[model samples]
Target: MTFRPISIFLSPNTEKDDVQLASKLLFKPWLWKKGKEILKFEEKFKKYLGARYAFSFNSGRSSLIAILEAMDIKKGDEVLLQGFTCNAAVNPILAKEAKPIFVDVDETINMNPEDLKTKITKNSKIVMIQHTFGWPAKIEEIKKITQESGLYLIEDCAHSLGAKYLPSQISKKLRRAKKLCGTFSDAAFFSFGRDKIISCVYGGMAVTNNKKIGENLKEFQKKMNYPSNFWIIQQLLHPVLMNYLILPFYNFLKLGRIFLALFLNLRLLSKSVVRIENRGELPSYFPQKLPNALTLLALNQFKKIERFNQHRQDIAKLYKENLEKRFILPFAREDKNREPIFMRYPLLVDDSDKILTKFKRRGIYLDDAWRKSPIVPPATDLKKIGYIQGSCCEAEKIAKHILNLPTHINISPNQAQKIIKLLLNAQ
Candidate 1:
């Protein structure tokens, strides 16, 4: 008997429009006027985020490097980051020739604000906070610490787009309060990658209210080009060919390892590793050029972001209602009045390895997302600053015990129920 496979996460592109547009663009090469599209996408995205400026890039990592470059973050400067996050978040700090100071995460799975204060030092120049799994960090407390210490705050909103965080008491008293997460930071970056809440197949954006950073990013964009036409064509065809055709073969044949190895070996999928300048070495900054095709794809998908976010929110709610008892759920901050567009539904469980094995036997897939700290040698002194030693203890425990069920637009209620039942049984 063939069992249905349940994946942990899926891109939000159920509509056939993305593929149709890709096909149209492929046929008419002249229609690939990326500059105009990129600018329009950037403007719309900026407006969506309520940010003053936005710039598109080939990937989230590149966008992050661009943000660090704009800020002039140099070698030896310590940037505080959460221990439990993707390499994309940490690699950029390394690219800037800076050292990442890994901080503990609170109950929300975001950076611990108190820990952030202790990490601040004379050498610390920036604090990079990720809104982990769509939960916003304690931005108000973090902002206060940064302000008092004269440090820069950079928000990594890779997991959050439609998410909102309410103003703090201080911010409310000021009458003109800043939004949490992205808005609280001096600059922020977002991803529209395949596994993200939004999907452009591959693309990212950098945003800021700071005029200088925006101008720098714009100047860099002027010199860059999109990925080649060949890449764009492949992306256009992937949804139909890879998702439906190739993926099924791999699943049926039980050739996942072989498939992954082959996929990684392909030149198109090879990782791009670029060395970034430390704080002071560059004469003039120019944003590195990314493939033009990615920019075009991101531009096309920017319009459907709201629908995508809504779907994710709905699915998250379902997971919460179904799985809350057996696992510890990460919820939107109660004090902050923001709705999160959950990128991943992370659950803390007991005996993760055993539960994962059980789920796998039942044809369910769960991601071991961000298990390793990308920052070389994770920080050891976070507790000195009153950071709860076990702040991210839940995440760390869940990282081993938790299972991420399919929470995408394509997942049916039946599929979700099946997953919930499995978890309940496991418990």
Candidate 2:
């Protein structure tokens, strides 16, 4: 018997305007004006994030590498990060020939500041914090610790773009709430991949308050050549294929990942381009140029971010109202500063494998997003630092037990309810 598949996460690219704008890039090739469009998008993203400088890159991973490179972190230096995160977040540190010191996560699935504080050593140079699955990390405590230790704090806001952190009491009474997550850190990165809330086909951005960092990032971006024209054409066609033929087929046949992996391996796939990393050394500069088409597409989508965020928020509410009683749902911060536009609705469960298996039997798709540990040295005392050691126990628990119900803008409330019911009854 066929069963309805409820995916954990889905792209929120349902708007007609988004579709039309994306099509324009495919049908019409106007490279000359793309730069201006990119700049416009950067400005809007910066404004939205309350960051001073926004630099777009080819992908979120590339942006992470660019930010680390721009910061001048080098070999033997240690960058503290959550143990549970995508390889993209961890690989860049290794690419720099720097050590990635893993830290444990708190209930929020972000870096535990307590764990972070313990990991700080003389060799520690940067603290890379991830806002995993759209839940905001405790930036206030992290900011304080990083400041006192003189360590550069880099917020990995890849999962939580529209998410906001309220000002601390001191900041609120004093009217001096520090910048948002991306702005709070020395640098932060965001992704605009196909599955992200903001789908620019494939793109990423790094934001910072330092003008010098922005300049350095731009210089590095300029050195990297733009993506090939053929690749740009492929990106332009991704949304059309994904929304119409591909997604429908996957949904109907319950072959989302099988088809996705096959599609990704195709030579024509726009995101297939790989940048060679110089082993055991940090490159002094980036050797790539952000694709003009990516920049233009990202810029155009920036205008509609508010609407996109709202949709995510609505979905989050539905998840909370429906799923929280049965699962460990995330709670909003007491501080009223900034509410999160959830990137993914994560939950903690007692038995992940069992839950996942049950869901799979029903053709419900709950992704175990970013289940690996950062490829850091084995003796980094990651567990001691509370960076849940042994391959992201927190992330694994969430991946196995937690279900990412379909919460995209395109999914109807009834669809979401159906997913919640399946999960609720599964237990």
For model 2, give the RMSD to the true fold: 4.8
TM-score per prediction, in order, is 0.83, 0.83
- Of candidate 1, the 10-residue stretch with the lowest lDDT total is 277-286
> Candidate 1: misplaced stretches above 4 Å?
1-4, 9-14, 28-33, 169-181, 228-234, 248-250, 255-264, 267-292, 332-336, 372-398
Candidate 2's C-alpha lDDT? 0.67
Over 292-364, each residue of candidate 2 has an lDDT whose tens digit, in order, gives: 6667667666667777778778887888888777888755334455577677776666765676777777666
Which residue runs does candidate 2 get wrong by more than 4 Å?
Answer: 1-6, 9-14, 32-34, 169-179, 251-262, 270-287, 332-338, 357-363, 371-400
* 373-394: candidate 1 lDDT, tens digit per residue: 2221123122322223454554
